[model samples]
Target: MDLTGPQLCYNYTSNVIGPGELKTFKCPASIEGRFVRITKHTVASTALRLCEVIVEVNADTCTILDLALNKSATQSTTYDDGKDHAGDAWRSVDGNLDPNMPVGQSCSHTDQVGHQWWQVDLVRYYHITQVSIQNRDVVPHRLGNVSVEVSETNNFDIHSEFYDAKLCHYYEASDVPASTLLILPCSDNIVGRYIRISKFVPILYDVLSFCEVIVEGGDPSCIQGTTGITATTTVTENTTDEQTDTTDSPEITSTTISLPSTCPCSCRGSIEKYYNRSIESLLDELREELMVSKKETASYTRTLVSVDDGRTSSRNIGYVGIVLLVAVGLSIVVPDVVSLAMYMKGK
Candidate 1:
């Protein structure tokens, strides 16, 4: 009997996953070896589910139809006719219909339709690092059973992986993963082109369904939009004085000089030249000292004469001393001569 082939399946599974809705669907055992492609996808932005279907075929087994749970991306399908879906990337839902269905997971949803489980792999296109899912949106939605798969090639399961539609452009990662967060090794520095996020439970309206996705490593600016600093100082005042060598403030080193007790007139002249003054002042000071020391001799005569530059003029001490010495010489000689003449006349 011509039982089952590809593309031919039961009624296309439909779901109303909102605030309070949940359901599960499955194909009969007779539909093995067949493929099921997504024809329609609709769900609110606040419901938590992994409700998506796909006839999964992997390894050495026949195709098995399954559902999904808590996934990364949300509703609003984009027809591959080169045009993306015209609706919002996420939707809103109210789960008033059902409340017992479980939630879906991102980059990690495994939908079990009966005796089999289906897993989505993101190795082919995405080098995923962290998988974050949360429901913080003001408009809560539901996540139906969604399926995901990965592979290196385009189609045809390549060893433990399923293939997804190829996309171009880097998807931004989340900061606060407003819903649920999954830390993944493949997420940090992931590099892929496609990530299909579908529903998990056909019927569990876990209200406030959300998923936050993040990549691992690369340009932090490109991922998180951040940029990283230095510091500096102004010129300081030098402690060493700048005027030390300036001509304005001459530096005088200590020095000492010794002179003999007495010298010829030449020495006096030299002393006067050293002081850059006339010798009259020096001689006046000496005369004053001599008059004070010993009352001037009887032969000493007061003489008034302008010396050179100023009032101290010349009271020549040397001249005074010479005059006294001559007077003493004459006095001694006269006494001796008078005695000798008396002796001669008496003889």
Candidate 2:
């Protein structure tokens, strides 16, 4: 296999994995590979086991759509001719479900050793639904306890690696043979471009093999659905003021009128102009009334002063007439009294 390719898509070193349990992994972009390998890295005596591997090609829903069909396949070690050969990896994804194929005709086989793996590349990113693997018709007992991983990169080195990938699914073997296809569906929307199937247990024969690996899902670009729409709105309002004159009670002057749209500011300008004209008219009327009131007050004050002066002059003329009458009476009475006294003394 291409050992110098990108980093691995998934890796597991835990020894607590039990039989019949499921595990999963995912990536963010596309991965390119042809083999998925497994290796025994833990201290447990359990053997590294794998029956099949699959890659999703559509959304997060498992269906008959296998995106890994006709894709390339590679392995860590291949068996010789007449034995389980390496080229059998492609036949699993070839969509031929003929379980009755002759030995080594429908499945790929690897040497019995540690750190063996198989990988496949899907070319581009896909919204993976689930991966399904079919166990070999012969010796299904060896296909137990395997680690499955998916990633956007091809770095197979599980140790000291950095990439965007995740374990979307995993499975622990049971005593019963995995004779039928084991379907490992992705839980969340796990997207990836590549898939890896590996074994990391130290069993008696640490050989990694599988009959078929089927990836079911679709391309990320062809997604179709509805989305939300956002919008914004603004509103403007105009107001009017009215003034009334109760003196003559003319038709109530109303400033409310239709605004003309000659420019953006024309409407507002017209309203302001009407208000200014009305205020100016009101001010002019008030000034005229104040002038008239001032004139009337001045005329009334002048008439009052003239009448008071005439009364004072008439009183002064009557006092002078009374004083002249009293002086005339006193002078005549004294002269008559003096003539009578002189006549009586002579007699």
**Whose TM-score is greatest here?**
2
Off by over 4 Å in 2: 1-64, 81-87, 100-104, 158-162, 175-178, 221-347
The Cα local distance difference test for each model comes to 0.34, 0.61
| TM-score result, candidate 2 | 0.43
**How would you encode candidate 2's per-residue C-alpha lDDT over 22-103 as one tens digit per residue?**
3455644555566656566756687767543445433343343678877987666666566444435576666654343363
Q: Please report how far candidate 2 places residue 130 from its true position, in Å.
A: 0.6
Model 2 weakest 10-residue run by lDDT: 226-235
Question: On residues 154-216, what C-alpha lDDT tens digit does candidate 1 reach at each position?
Answer: 353443222433221222332223232323233222233334444333333232233333222
Number of the top candidate by lDDT?
A: 2
Model 1 — which ten-residue stretch has the worst lDDT? 59-68
- Report model 1's TM-score to 2 decimal places: 0.20
lDDT of 1 at 100: 20
